[model samples]
Target: MRLSELSVGDHGVISDITGLPPEQRKRLVALGLLPNTPVQLIRRAPLGDPIQIRLRGGDLAIQKRIANCVEVCLK
Candidate 1:
């Protein structure tokens, strides 16, 4: 499944980030969202364009477009 498809409060592990642009992929990796790393969907904006995720001890607000680029597996 894609990260954007995960429900709020759900946990999932990153399976692939290669689907994203090189710069975006690098940015996410630096944010600790690497393959095999677990992440939780914390919340989403009212319109849902941006979603909050928890991973590696930090929370990041990622755009839905970017979120969709992240492949994930449910934990």
Candidate 2:
């Protein structure tokens, strides 16, 4: 499933990141979102513009449109 489809408190391992340019992929990796990393869904913005995820000892918020491109497997 895509990262955007995960619910609050859910945890998953990233399987792939597609449809993004190299720079974008590198940015995500720098944020500790590399493939195979486990992440947790924390919450979503009230307006749903972005979703908060817990990773790498911190929380990071990502736009839903971008989240949709990240495929993950439940952990």
Best by TM-score: 2
Q: Candidate 2's error at 71, in angstroms?
A: 0.7
Please list all clashing residue pairs in model 2, or write none if there are none: none
* Candidate 2 Cα errors over 4 Å, as ranges: none
What are the per-residue Cα lDDT tens digits for candidate 2 across 1-75? 999999999999999999999999899988888888999999999998699999878999999999999999999
- What are the lDDT figures for the candidates, one per model? 0.91, 0.93
Q: Estimate each model's TM-score.
A: 0.94, 0.94
Candidate topping lDDT: 2
Q: What tens digits encode model 1's per-residue C-alpha lDDT throughout 1-75?
A: 999999999999999975677887888888888999999999999999899999988899999999988999999
Candidate 1's TM-score reads 0.94
